[model samples]
Target: MTIDGISSTQGEDGVQEFDVLIIGAGPAGLAAGIYARRAGLSCLILEKGVPGGQVLTSPMIENYPGFPEVPGMKLMDHMAEHARRYVDIREGEEIVRVKGGERFEVSSGAGKYFSRALILTTGSTHRKLGVKGEDGMTGRGVSYCATCDGFFYKTREAIVVGGGNTALTDALYLHSIGCKVSIVHRRDSLRADKHLQESVAERKIPVLFDTVVEEIVGADEVTAVKLRNMKTGVVETKPVNGVFVAVGEVPSNQLA
Candidate 1:
């Protein structure tokens, strides 16, 4: 038997003919495509933005198998390209609505691509600081992962936003790596574990209590952070090479 094309049927009678419509071009989505195509099923990939999803923004990934070290952006591109060799791959499209019945109704920006089954692989988005230029300068200097962007600021000063264990740990890591670290917390009290907090304190990482980053100052890259004393209402500028938003990050599973 031969594989049929996805656009062959109109689905006007509301009957899906294709085997699968994978939403998202992430690792999970592309892996599904490989399996579906190998199983001789018609598969189509629907992606809202550039293919590879949020993984593209990741700086580096060393935990994955085979390759000892690989950039997240490069890995995503390779996955998308490899999946295309087995199935029809499309990009830069979003599924606004999905209706399921005997078949499925997928309404996208480009058009609807119907399939008998669906694989939802839409991933998560990073929880931003909501500060101006923070979203725009992500990956440029503003990062969430100390493992990824830490090496870039070797022997340089960096600022971490948060008072919890993660933020303190990040500060310690940077401090150990010869980088001066500053912890800016929104509240005066730290909520980190006792041991971790003590470790951070022992390191002598400057703790700016009752403080929050009002603004991240930089021209091309991270140059400094505008910190605000929540109690005194005083604003101070601290020189730094990079700013890590350890406040938090949320998965981009809103679509899912």
Candidate 2:
């Protein structure tokens, strides 16, 4: 089981082999385990959690080219410390079961591996607005991460459901951290881009547009948000202590 320090090669029925398993540790499975260990092979990765998947909930990142800004968990912790110097990551595991042709096996609660190539990268998953109290108010104030909960809603008050580009970049990162943001949008223009709708109208924020949240009120945290509007069918409620959501993304692929 010693990954990273190497020694976990077994394969004469002992399983746990690998000339490249990958799965997902994000950043495309840590750049396909550093190009499958610089093309020499061995590789591994795995990772069910903890390895910067959704760019670790991205707070700042000026389009990764040469780190013009950098933050998404410090650029995935420098790409998982440069793919752990050469593969074999293993964080938490979670493969479940795979089994393909000439090699592949996989499984995972804690064992069975083998792999003559199987790279999934498994990314996306953050698109829920199925309304109604949103799964018991998600982490309390309900959030799909505005930089991982936007500093606990800085000055407080938040909304940002969706209008694209990750809900206007999480309403300009919850109005640049002081929170008090808004933006509901069930339509009525704004699919973000045009410099993020001109930086959310030069930072005036507010927005609501055609609205539509319809429930996520709160009892142990979020405190308000019922909205409706969609061309004046009206219905209000909007107090807000945080909600964020960002509406889009759903392809973790269920281990395809």
Candidate 3:
């Protein structure tokens, strides 16, 4: 077969060839693309989702090398744009299977391509609570991102899960925007940095120790959450319009 009446001779195997194939479009993948392109290698980046990855969902980033307190999406955009100048990137293309051999054959739904060197920068996915009403009320009221769903909770009360850096940061952001936010932690102490811990105390944000989110309660939107005391086995219901799950992330190392 041929396109535009021309022969399609991608060898007999029908796989496109490339010197390097980078999977993912996050910071690591983009950086790899830049290096490969600068080395004068035929490189291609296959991104299953958006180009910027999790950076797009970050609210604010303060400690990135040069920039001070820049928006996450803005920072990721710049990184993606900088890589685009030298590398060829294909967004919305997922590398479903990777065949190892003398050369790696990358297969996706769109097509198949072979590369001498394969680099996987598949970042990570947010871990879910798997509680009742969570999967059903994802976008409606329950969310995993503060930067993406914080604005919608203006002047409303919100509940933040976990006690890590992400959870603390999200709580502070929510409080800043007129939302009365509370932290529910399964541990007595937070796993965040000391500075953040001090800030949380300074901000007077309530943290329920040994507390776990049992269920996300709401109808059309999130109205409250059912929390259980891990130590005493006492269950309490708190009114909240938003719930941000910042528990942790599951690495995308399946291809690796």
TM-score of each: 0.61, 0.38, 0.90
Q: Give candidate 1's error at residue 184 in angstroms.
A: 4.9
Candidate 3 lDDT over 1-256, as tens digits, reads: 3322322236346666777889999999999989987877777889998789888887788779899889888999999999988776788898899999988888889999887899999999999998998988988889899878899998988888999989998988888887888999999899998887898899999999999999999889888899999999999899889999999999999987
Residue range 69-151, candidate 1, lDDT tens digits:
78778998889889888876667888888888887878877676677898888876545687766866777788887766888
Best by TM-score: 3
Highest lDDT against the true fold, candidate: 3
Model 2: per-residue lDDT, tens digit, 1-256?
Answer: 5555545578877777877788879898898788877777677888888887987777777778999988789899989998888876778888888878898888889888887879888888888999788897788898888887788989999888889887888889888878898988888898877888898899989888888899988788888988989898889897888898888888887767
- Misplaced by over 4 Å in model 3 are 1-14
The candidates, ranked best first by lDDT, are 3, 2, 1
Kindly provide the TM-score of model 3 when superposed on the true structure, using C-alpha atoms: 0.90
Of 1 and 2, the candidate ranking higher by TM-score? 1
lDDT, candidates in the order shown: 0.77, 0.84, 0.87
After the best TM-score superposition of candidate 2, give how far the Cα of residue 126 lies from its true spot, in angstroms.
Answer: 2.0
Worst 10 residues of 2 by lDDT: 1-10
Positional deviation of 59 in candidate 2, in angstroms? 6.0
